[model samples]
Target: MLTRRTTHTTLALAASLSLAGALAGCAAEAEDSAATPPQPTTDASSSGAGDGSTDTLAGDAGTEYSDGTYTAEGSYQSPAGQENITLEVTLAGGTVTEVSLTSDATNPSSKQYQGQFISALEGAVVGKNLDEISIDKLAGSSLTSIGFTEALDSIKSEARA
Candidate 1:
């Protein structure tokens, strides 16, 4: 019942439609990919924002270690009340690499004091031998040193290799 001319026409139309459909799909994918913005990647060691100072993780400053990370807690009584502090330290090649300190100071004045202590600690503890670290007063926060020492003592024990 079909004529040769009709059959040839139908085949040609079908092939053209299929090709067009595939090209459209590819064009849509390309558009979607172009519309998305590329995300920026950051290096861990790279410094950014605020005076080019690198903000790195803390390290423990006392006695040689097997080169790893360690944490210890410290506390002491101030005029305000009992103050709690936590320290995380990093050791590399048997030397203190960094020291990170956190405090549980609730009082407003204590908060200020703790901030000062931490700032002072960077200069005093960083790159020093853990066994040689004996900070007496940091940024006028002399009272907290006892607690800090206590925590260091524990860190030494825990980090013993």
Candidate 2:
């Protein structure tokens, strides 16, 4: 009888440990997902503004733009859903002197990719001619570039001299 009790107790303890381990693992996974969600992957072939539409650029060749700051909001459909970003850009001599991007992404994956895009935006755009900027991908976030290009198109129209 004592051996039977001991065996039952051992099995109960093993089951309890397994349950506890599974719960702990689930909590850890939830925490990890909340803290560093996965970035939304984008296909490279369809990621860029490859339509060759130059009319959205800063007017025309040797076009002089009014040196000032402009803001615009752009939206794109991601795998998560609709995501939007707002850009504030300062242009001088048709060159992007300073730029800032604010994201309105509710989905975790979209937010992660937008954050990645923001982290790498300035280095890629700053001090570059606004007309020459053609961002295909930055910080492994290709979808965000579509919104950025849309915003930039608006800025170009608003900042044209």
Candidate 3:
């Protein structure tokens, strides 16, 4: 009787050990299933880097005209309406090399304002590469400044195409 009891106790212990090992294996598999999969990286070489020579015209205002020498266009409404800006962008080597600005409000009273706006735009984009030209809001003239920057962005898009 003592031998039989000892054998039964040993068999029970062995069974419990086997059950614990199986549970551990199942838990490990569950943990692996919960882990996130690796994400693929983007390849910049395959993506086309824009040459940045197209024109971006925003607002309900602004027009773009193309001449043989250069693209001539203006973005504006009436003098009393929303501000309009014209940007004459010169491109060479698939980049914006020069930017000229014109505005509809050019009277003696507002001439200085318009001139200052144009000067600010020209200064902002004169020698910068098309990819590097980004204009946030200008200090004094936000509207005209945004319009000018949009025009340059547009031009850069066209050049890329």
Candidate 4:
């Protein structure tokens, strides 16, 4: 009877450990597959490794930017295919006063991520200088930033005085 009880205890412990391991694995997979979008924060230190241009426009174009809103279509390659986004920014005294993004992604996944990026864009860029507005990732969307950066570069050219 003692030996039988010991065996039953060992079997119960093993089954419990297996169930716990399976649960952990499922949790990990869920976290990786659909990560919760990051909330927009007030921290100003989340700038990405930008394209290395300062307040001055690229290629000796100088830093004098026209005070107005500019729009441009930015494109980037994604796993599904090429994706594009329309980006608009309002500038006042070389500072970003407003920002917006329109996602043109046809792929559902791409569209979802772009929507996440768009949702977080104003917090990332509004009130920043034109050259200081680059972002590598926001709202758990990294690839969308590439398209945003491209669009921002075009806007800078359009806004250059």
What does candidate 2 score on TM? Answer: 0.63
Candidate rank order under TM-score: 2, 4, 1, 3
State model 3's lDDT: 0.59
Give the poorly placed runs of model 1, Cα more than 4 Å off. Answer: 1-63
TM for every model, in the order presented, reads 0.59, 0.63, 0.46, 0.62
How well does model 4 score by local distance difference test?
A: 0.84
Candidate 2 regions with alpha-carbon error over 4 angstroms: 1-61
Give lDDT tens digits, candidate 4, residues 50-143: 5443342263324778999899999989999999999988999889999889986789999899999889889888988887766899999999
Pick by lDDT: 2 or 3, better one = 2
The Cα local distance difference test for each model comes to: 0.82, 0.87, 0.59, 0.84
Among these predictions, the greatest lDDT belongs to: 2
Residue 49 accuracy (lDDT) in model 1? 55
Score residue 88 of candidate 3 by CA lDDT.
Answer: 79
Deviation in Å, model 2, residue 154 alpha carbon: 0.4
What is the per-residue lDDT of model 3 for residues 1-161, given as tens digits with 9 covering 90 to 100?
56988999999999999999999999998888779576645444454555534333322123332321244343534344555566777765544567677766655534555577776776776665556666655546544555666666566445543
Poorest 10 consecutive residues by lDDT, candidate 3: 60-69
